[model samples]
Target: MNKTLVAGALALTLAGCASQQPAPPFTLTLAHINDTHSHFDPSDARLTLDHKAVFTRLGGHPRLLSHVNELRRQAEEAEQPLLFVHGGDAWQGTGYFTLNQGAMNADVLSRMQLDAMALGNHEFDIDNQRLAAFIQGVNFPVLAANLDASHDPDLKGLENLKPYVLYAFDGHEKERVDSVKDAGKRPVVAVMGLVLEDMPDMAAHTGNLRFEREVDSAQRTVRALREQGVKQIVAVTHLGLERDQRLAREVNGIDVIVGGHSHSLLGQFSNLGWADGAPYARQFTNPDGRGITCVVQAGQFAQAMGQVSVTFTPDGRVSRCEGGNTLLSDNVFYRDIRRGEQHRLNEQQTQRLKAEIASQPNIAMVAEDPALRAHIDKQYLPALNRAYGEVIGHLPQALKHVRLPVDGSGSQIAPLVAASQLYWANTPEVLAVTGRRADFALVAAGSVRNSLEPGALKEGHVGLELLPFANPISLVSLTGRQVAGLLLETINASLPADAHTGKFPYAAGLRYTFNETSKGRGYLDRIEFLSQGHWQRIEPDTRYQVVLNSYHASGNDGWSTFFDSQQAFTDRLDLAFTNGKLTAFPVARLSKVNGGGVQVHYINQPLNCQDQAVRCNTDARAFIDYVRERRPMLTALPESGVTLKRL
Candidate 1:
C-alpha cells in the first residue's frame, strides 16, 4: 500500500475509535411540591354565562399522585432518574388534617413515595407527640439539619430521621462501566434538608424543639455530605424564598436548592448572588467547577409541580440541564368533569380518586367545626336575641343590604363593629368612635363577616348577627402618622377608581376623601379627625395610643404603616372584653348618627339609592356601593349588626 493511503486509513481508524467512545453524561430529575395543606376537595363551583358549571379545581392528593405518575413516566422516557421531594408545611391548615393529627396527609404523602420532606412550621401545630406519631407513620424521612430533636418529647422521636439522603442512579452504560470498574465507581447524588430558623417561634406549640439558622445548618450538612462522598448535593429548604436565596448564596457546596414557604412560582432555575461582600455571583458550581447551583420552588397548594433535571458528566460534574415547572391543572390528561370537558385524568381514574376522597370521614370538618354548630344553637343565637331585645323599630320595606359600598372605599360596618367590641371591652377612658387613631380603634371591613337584617330590632341580635369570625381582640399601638399611612395604604390598595366597582374599603370614624383624578394612588387627599364633637385636621407628627386587632396591627391586608410607628402595645381583643368592665342598656331608639366629629360625603355622586339614603352620608353611601358590587362574589355576608361576646 502507498504510504499516503496508509496514513489516511490510520487517521480514519482513529476518528472511528473516537466516535465509539461513551456518551457525555447521565441526567436526573428532581420533582418537588409544597404546602399541599390537605385540601382534599377542589375549589368552589360557579355557573358561567353558558349555564355550564365552572369549578376552580385545586389540590387533592390523588390528583397530585396522578401528576407524579405522569412526570415519572416522562422522566423515564427521557432517560432521566427521578427523585420526588416535598418542601413541607403539609399539616394543620385544614380541619381534616387538624382532626386527624396529620394522619391523612401522612398516608397520602407516603403513597406519593416522597424521597424526603423539609420540616415546615405547621408540622408542629399539633403537639410534639402527634408530630412524632406522624413521623413514625410516614415511610420517608423528614429532613431538617437544623432541628434539635434531642430533648423535647414531641420531637425526640425525630432523632431517628436522617438529616440527608444520597441517591444513586445507574443507567445501562454506567452499569456496564460499574461492572467492569472498581466497586467504588458508582455515581451518587446527595440531598440535604434544612428547616427555617423561625420555625421555633412559629411552630412553638408543636414542642420545645430548637432550630438553628438555615444557612448555618445547610453549611454543616453540605460539609458532612461531602465527607461522606456525596458527588452532587441538593438542599430541600422549608424557609421562605428570601431566606432560600440567602442559603444558596451563603452555602458553597450545594448544587441545587429545592425551596418552599413563601410559595414562589419559579418556572426555571435561576442564579442567586451572594451578599454584597461575596467575591462573585452565586451560581451552580459542582465539585469540579463544571456547573452552577440551581434553586427552584413551586407555588403553594398542589396547583403546580417543580422539576429540575440535571445531567452529570463522567467526572461527576453537572454538564447540561433542562426543566421547567409544570401545572398539572392545565394538562389535558385529567378531565374536569364539572367543566363538561374531557381534560386530564380519565373518567375511571377521576372517579376512583373521588371515591377515595368520599371514603374519608370528617373531611367537611376542615372548613367548619361541630363546635361552631353547637355555639350557633346554644350561645350565638341566644346572644343575638338578647342584644337586639325589645323591637325598637321596623324597616318600612325589605331594603337591599350590602356589606360594603360599591365604590372603592372603607365601609362603616367595620368601624361600627369595632366600636361595639370596644363597648363590650369597656376599657377605662377609652375613646369610642368609628375612625383612625394611633393606639385607637381600627378594624378592616373584610374582617366583618355578617350583617344585620331590615326587620324589627330585637335583643341579642347585635351579638349574634354582626361579625361571625369574632376573633380574639388584639391591641397594638402606633403613631398618628403611622395610623394614617395604614389607612391610606388600605384604601389605595383596595379602591383605585380605574379598577372594578367593588373592591376592599376602609371604615373609619375619621373623615377622609381622595381626589381620584389627581392624587397618585388616590390616598387620603382630604383628611379630618374627630375631636370632642367636630371634624379637625390631623397633625402628621401627633402620637396616640391605638387599640386594634392583631390582624390589622400586624399589618395584614396592606396595613404595614402600623409597623412603621413608634412604641406599640398589643393584647387579645377577647381578653380585653372579658377582663374589662361590661354594661347592658336598653335600646330606646335607633339613631341615624352616633357620636361623631368627622362626616364623609361622596365627591360627585349620591352614596346610595334615594330610598336607601335615609342615613346615607358619603362614607355610608360609598360603603353601600362597595358591598352591593361584592355581594355576588362572596359566599355569604356578615349577619347584619350581630355581635358575639366571648366570656
Candidate 2:
C-alpha cells in the first residue's frame, strides 16, 4: 500500500509539470538583401578557404534567387516564418542599369515577388517621371513615408505607393496565403516604410516633392499600426544602419529594421570570418521600455543574404531572436577545428555546408547573370557595342593603383584621371557654366574603378573601368584656404594613423605636404597649385577653381568640406552669370561646337533634364574625348608617388 501511494504521488507531480508547459511562440524568419545596385552578375572575387586564397564567383541574381528559394524551402519544412525583403537602391551602378534604365532590374525583381522595398536615393537618379514608370512593373508595394510626392502629378499616378502598409502572414501550422489583415483582425507581421529625409542632398531633388522628418513619420506610423492590433512591426528603410539604430531606440513598436544606403557589412566575426562589421542582427531596446527592435543589413550586391529567426510573446513583445548572414560565395568554405570554437565549421560541418549549398540550383560562373546576359546579348549589348566598343585610343602601359601605398592609392590611373578631369574641366564645353576656368583637379582615390590596362583599349573599356557609374564631371570654386583645409582632412584620414583611406585626394595640378604630428585642419604643412609651369603656394581666402566628378563635388566619399557649398554649383561646367567680371569666353552665352565630332554624351549644363537630352554622360566619354584629342600614344606619369609629398 505504501509503495503504490508513492508511485501515485510521483505520477501526479509529473502530470502537473506536463500541464504547465510554455505556450507556442510566434516565430518569424526574415530573409533580406540590401543595396543590390543592379549587380545581376556573378563576378570573380577572391576569398580564403582552408587558409589559402581562392578565386570564386561571388554573386548573381539567379544564384541569389536560388539561395533565397533554398532558404524558403528549409523554413517552410520547419514551419518557421519567412519574409524576403530588399533594402533599396535597386537601380544605378553597372552597365545593366545604365543601358536599360532600371527596366531590366524592375522586371527581374518583380518576378521575385518581394514583400516590400524602400525607395532608395538612386531610385530618383532618373527623376520622378521614370520612377513612376518603374513602379508600374513592380507587383509589390514600394514604400516611402517621408517623401511627400502627392504634390507631383506623375507620382500621384501610382496608386500603389503609400506611407505604410499592412501585411498579414501566418507562421503557425495553419495558412499559406499571406495577405492584408482586415480591421480588428490579428496580423502575423506589419511592415512600414521610412526613407531618409535628406533626399535633396543625396539624390536628384525635385520641386514638387518634399521629405518629412524620419522619426516623426515613424512614430506616427507605429502608433497607427499598433491601434489596429498589429503586433510585429518591421520598418523597411534607406536611412542606413547608424540612423536605423537610433530610429529603433527612439521610436517604440518597431520590432525589426531592414535598411540600406551605406552598403555596409554587418555580421559576427566568428560565423562570418570577417573581423570588421556590425553583427548580422543587433537588438536595440526602445527608450519607452517596450519590446526590442532587431536591425540587420545584407551587404551590397547580394553578396550575402541575412536570415533572422525571431520569436515574439503573445502580447507582441520580443521574446527571443537569433540569426546571421549566409555568405553566397558559391564555393567551398573550409576551416580547421583544431584552432577553436571561434573558427566554426570543421571538416564534416564544412562539407555538409558546402554540399547543402551545392544542392541548390545555380548558374554558370560568369561575371553577369545568364538571364541578364542573354537579355543584354539580344538587344542592349548591340547598342553598347556599337556606341562604346570602338578602339578610340590605346594604353601602351597598364595604369593601376590596387597595390599602391599612397593611402588607398591605385596605379597610374589616379594621376591620369586627375589629369583627364582637369583637362575636360578646362575644355570650352565644360567651362561655360561656372564662368571660371579650373585652376586644379581633385579626385577621390575610390573613383578609379580599375586601372587602365596596356594594349588596345576600346571605348567600352572606359565604361568598364573609370565610369562604371558614368558620373559626369563638374567644376567648383574654392578659396585657397578651403583647398588647404580639404588636403589637411584627407591627410589626417590616411596612414600611419589609418593605413588605407580611399578618400585620399588625387590631384593633377595640385600637391600638398603634411606633417604627421598634427591632425584635423592643420595637418597640412603647405599647399601648392601648379599654374603655367611653376608651383605657387595656395594662399588662404584666395579663390582657386577645382574640377572633379559629381561624386566628389557632391561631398561624397570623404571630402566633407564641399557639402556646405553644394548650392553654389552650376550645371556641370557652364558659362553663367556673374562670377566676377566675366573676362573672356561668351559670358552668359552658351557655346555650340561645330561638326568636328558627333556628340554621344549629354553635355553638362544648368538644366534639370540636361543628362536626359543625351544618350550618355559618363566619365568614360569625357576621358575618351580627352584621349582622342591627344591620341597615338598616351604619356605615363613618373615612377614614384609624385602627386604629393612630406615636407
Report, for every candidate in turn, its global Cα lDDT versus the true structure. 0.51, 0.65
lDDT string, candidate 2, 118-174, tens digits: 998778777677888888778778888777776777787476787666655554232
In candidate 1, stretches whose alpha carbon ends up further than 4 angstroms from where it belongs are 1-24, 44-56, 75-79, 157-160, 171-185, 204-207, 268-291, 330-471, 476-647
Candidate 2: worst-modelled 10 consecutive residues by lDDT:
591-600
Clash number for every model?
Answer: 74, 9
**Regions more than 4 Å wrong, model 2:** 1-23, 172-186, 205-207, 268-275, 331-388, 391-416, 426-437, 444-457, 464-472, 484-506, 512-526, 531-536, 550-572, 575-618, 625-647
Q: Please estimate how well model 2 matches the true structure, expressed as its whole-model Cα lDDT.
A: 0.65
For candidate 2, give the lDDT of residue 165.
67
TM-score of each: 0.55, 0.74
The true-versus-predicted C-alpha distance at residue 403 of model 1, in Å, is 21
Best by lDDT: 2
Identify the candidate with maximal TM-score: 2
